[model samples]
Target: MTTSIEPGPSRYSFDNDDPESVGRHSHLSNILDPFTFQRLGTLGDLAGKRCLEVGAGGGSVARWFAEQAGPTGDVLATDLNVRHIPLDAGFRVLRHDLVAEPVPDGPWDVIHARLVLLHIPQREAVLARLAESLAPGGALVIEEWATEFGNLCLAAPDDEAAGLIDEYRDTLVNRVLPGRGNDPAWAARVHATMLANGLVGVDTAIDAASWPGGSPGALLIAVNVAQLHDDFIAAGFTEERIQRLYAAVQDPRLVVRSHFTYSTIGRRPGGS
Candidate 1:
């Protein structure tokens, strides 16, 4: 599929090449895989299905689905940052943009994207495109963050830390990032969005995490700070505050509950 409208640039790009961020995403996928599989399991055997994994960072879920699909089914894993997903059996990866280009022509039996659409300014249009790509009765599962306010609250070991996080989230994170076109609220509206696009049986499950000191989420918080330090500085956050937050994040005693995410599922209306 070829068309040139320019996918353009995202407000923020994941530094996939960075060792810290790469390691963070790898563990991130492991931590979040179960909730996704819970929904996937309900879809029954993928032995003969056609599946698409969009923005398939790390590609763990796509690899699993390809295994389940066995010899009969096929799976395509895609991301703009194309990394080689493990398990080549019945698996393929593509460097594709969900917004600008068409999905592979064959209608999909299941389409899944986690944390993908929220980053897109053209999310609604892409959602429409996803619906169009589905085979009759295909399921689409979208997992995304519901609110960063909950994530913000995790910074509090005390009132002082809480205040710092509140300042950081409100001033630096939310206002600065959204200007580039990421919607942290889109997860909460998945059911409504899917229904409006003529999908049926739309359901949502919200999941939040409590991270221990050595856990993946803890690392992600630190990695995020490293990635966005410039943005924070530009947003007028003090160098001192950034340093404090960075130090606080490394505390071995730290524990925090992250914001919730919705693993929302909807199916195209049609028959087997």
Candidate 2:
């Protein structure tokens, strides 16, 4: 089958090349890996299955997949930038663009992408392609951040600090992310999209936990703020305001509920 996948007008908002991104990915892995791994575990034993991990930041989950799939299994990890994914790991690594490049040949048993598709403007199309690439009885697991409930500031030292957190989220989620072609609300639509694409037994599980200041979740917020500092400024956030927001997120007194993580999984039909 041939495809006419074209590059989108904008690329990912975060850059893996930045030195700070190492810490960012680490923080994300620490915060999200447990849930991601648990979701993958639901597929039962993957001893000989072929797995693909897309947009594999820091390669933590890919490494986990390698362990689960074992020596007889095949695991491939791919991303637009693979600087952080080590070649020495027990899996194959590919630096491939999801937009302008052809997807690798696959009748894969499992394909997983975390916090990836929401950043692509042509996500629905890419999703269709991914679904088509699945092997019979294969699973596609997508984990995305949804802003439906917003990033709630549950506790703060004061009302002013709380307001700053809200303002920062407004700028980041509404202005900055969209400016980079991200769809902040895409998570809610994944289920319907999967169903429309003829995937079976689609399920969406939502999870969120409170993040206190100085925790991995809060640190992720700080890392993102630093990485997107310029974009935040371009979004009309003053330097002083940005600084305050950063400090607020680390105040220890501040507690927040991060955006909902929607883990949507589906299976292809007809396999034993």
Candidate 3:
């Protein structure tokens, strides 16, 4: 017999007294910035449509969606953990787990999730839930990182450090995060998953962009590397090895290439 675990309270409810530490640790804002404008563009017009944003970390995307929907439209943002949400007139932030909480009643014109599904082990189940919440003709958008984007390189002369970074990368792509195991093929799989679950007019688009040379990109990459380095050390890698990896990553000659994929705009069968 399969045992079902009761869903716990919202995963996003952080302590009000610890906002500073929480904000510093929250990488969702930086990690999500690159795709914000692009995601909005992909969403098309939503001048007066109800919208749901799942995993609206820090309310960045939620704010954007609220702006697009205007006062006439409503945007409900939900996440397992409630951090800092900017005060906005029409935006409503809720502490709810998409898997457990009933999706707010929606014949929503649009629903979107970005960089959110990678952490979810139950991708198919979540997609099914999102699909069911849609009104006929409603659009569902999902974007995820492809495993192929896990490229990290260091110009350091120390081969040992490079090796360690590689190992950490493997862990990050395969184990550290729950469903990131399917990173490379996540978009394609999601496409099929949605269709299989009864969505129609499915379409997918892959976005590939380079970080090139910029402090913003460099800083973000360095922070991510540092996080991975800490994880590696915790997982038995030596401190020296982690240091060496960071050194190589900081080298000017090493160019890191990341490729991201997105599957946007699947529709519920029948017109709303």
Candidate 4:
């Protein structure tokens, strides 16, 4: 097991109290989480099952797991820097570093990670570790954004604002990512990775959605624009341009289309 943390690209904060982070959390819990649960719910009840939730940001999903597992099952919600989460007897939080160690304890019935592996330098190793942690007949679910420029776009384009948005996006892609030039399309390979790592019944899907003026995605992106204003300035973007794009994101007439979100699910063979 690797005892050292792998250096990676600059990560966007998932801080619990920060407004931007809160907005992003709301976006996930209110919008994306339901969509995810709908898919996983089809797999059947989680009652009495142990779940492992990686990168448990605000712990919304962790809470969901606890509710589904009821009082009988338990969940281990972990992150490097956990802030706020509603907890219960069945749910517990741990400050864990995936790169520095293997899963604390598992043979987990369900392992789910969202937007986590893409930021980690040792993603492949981490995936192997997660695979190993799954119990026979367990399920692993992973989701990541195919986060590239062309993948995300402003639906109601304002040429002027578009230019600024492009500039900010470019800075993130070129200057800010904290990894060793890892593939941006890594999420696209998740299904294959899980299959190769000794999983079966692998399946994959992609989703795209429109963020209308006041939608969670809009709010989240608006937060992102404000959060990274300083970075954009440091990257040679003008304050005026950045401010303009920020305003545009908040405009009710503006529509933003998120990049395609990719998800994969695989199961360990055997009865739980």
Candidate 5:
């Protein structure tokens, strides 16, 4: 038998030689802090456990987890684009796509996917696969963004540009991205999904905060918005409008807050 498969979007590629791909920028740490370390701490000790970090971008979080797991434990960090994973003695990196390929066999003590589900359209199916990989009494931790248009404020020089920025962001987040609007309810949905997939003891914890001023969180927001200017212009926004929006993002008065939610620790039944 023969099969034909259409190519997916080129979101992840091996060409991670860009300087931005390797840096230890505080901006990323700030944006990921609420979901990553803070929530992971709630999962208790990880030493001597087998852990898997899906979508381990740049392997930063995986590296941190490796430290927590220590020499007695093992960590496997996998990404669609594994080229960005730096050499590490404690962890193994593999290139895997949850949607198209089978997840590696795991009776893992913990399976983690942070800020990753939103990018995959078949989230429920992926959740089922993750559940199958969990060991008895193992945990699955997930974190995703909740982006609402009215919830975000722009600090542009004028109202018109600010509105355009909001529109562009909304369109990209809702239409271009794989998931629906990043709502807080997404946590509940994910928790329910895991429960339906036969996981036991499903629960969620939500964290919300604003990125203000020149903080790293604010800077990450600025950088992502700036990078999307061209896409906004291509989507019918004028160059003048794009520049105006950029300026607005730099305004000190504008506060951009994202609702971050984590649905963590869906344990497998029976502790098999």
Candidate 6:
């Protein structure tokens, strides 16, 4: 799920308030959270740490942080629409607009955002702000998708299904998403940007896997259909074509490459 925490149609393409967003977050969490947790685990035990989770969609990662922080620590999960975040999870939730409002007062031990900053035109500025908010020696972890490698369809129900996947992929990468201000190229730049923002020991890793139909990866495509069918219709894709794409992703015979996820980690200087 792309966590566009700024509300309104003018700010983002996907709406967290939409019912489909729950599935979107779940499918994405299934596919991505393990890797995310692995990276964060390198920071050592988070007991008594103050953590901030920006653009928390379904709050899976925030809940993890809360569990790690325990009763004495603090975890703040913020999004423009916070309806999906659990209230009893020992963390606080806020109706935050990442693009418009100031960052919460955080000299935080850890700050994390996944599938978020690339959607904001002010991403570079936001990166700097996040770096500055970190407590000395605190870590920042950001994850984003890089789709430039193109979808490789290994198998499909038929030639039409294969072609539909390509067409839909192109339309999403080149048209609809960019029109909503998504920068597909930004993931590749996060490492250097973090370095320039005065963070030390910046590192990044990329993860991708085959997305066979009916798997969580393919479920992501189906969830996208529910979230963006209207956008496809507006982009001159027929209703049948949109639905066919959905069906193709659900067919076990179809296989495609998953989007490459760039996970970048950096730390503020001067802390052990």
Q: Candidate 1 lDDT, tens digit per residue, 89-183?
A: 45877768777688877699999998888878998889888988999999988888765564455544667665665675676447666876778
After superposition, candidate 3 runs with Cα above 4 Å error: 1-36, 148-151, 154-165, 178-184, 212-214, 225-231, 247-251
Mark the regions of model 5 whose C-alpha exceeds 4 Å error after superposition.
1-26, 154-165, 178-187, 225-230
lDDT for position 39 in model 5: 74
Q: Given candidate 3, what's the lDDT at residue 117? A: 74
RMSD (CA, Å), each prediction: 3.9, 4.2, 6.3, 4.7, 5.7, 3.3
Q: Give the alpha carbon lDDT tens digit for every residue of 50-100 in model 2.
A: 999999979899899898998899899888877788777789888788988
- Runs in model 6 deviating more than 4 A are 1-10
For candidate 4, lDDT tens digit of each residue in 133-219? 999999999988787646355555567655655665677666655433445678898988998899999988888888776778767
lDDT of 6 by residue, 1-272 (tens): 12323343324567877888888888988999999999889889999999999988889999999989988889999877776777777788877878788899989999999999988889999999999999999999999998666756878989999998888888787878888888988999999999999999999989888888989888788688678888877887788888888889989999988888999999999986
* 3 or 4, greater by TM-score: 4
Q: What is the lDDT, from 0 to 100, of the residue 103 in candidate 1? A: 80
- The clash number for model 3 is 8
Candidate 6 worst ten-residue window by lDDT: 1-10
Error of 6 at 8 (Å): 8.8
Error of 5 at 92 (Å): 1.2
Candidate 4: residue 155 lDDT (0-100): 59
> What is the Cα-based TM-score of model 5?
0.81
Go through the candidates in order and give each one's C-alpha lDDT: 0.75, 0.86, 0.63, 0.74, 0.66, 0.86
Q: What is the lDDT of candidate 6?
A: 0.86
Q: How accurate is candidate 1 locally (lDDT)?
A: 0.75
Q: Alpha-carbon error at 38 in model 5, in Å?
A: 2.1
Mind giving the per-residue lDDT tens digits that candidate 3 earns over 112-193? 8876676566667888888898977888888776764455643334565456556656765655443333444566688888
- Per-model TM against the reference: 0.88, 0.94, 0.77, 0.88, 0.81, 0.94
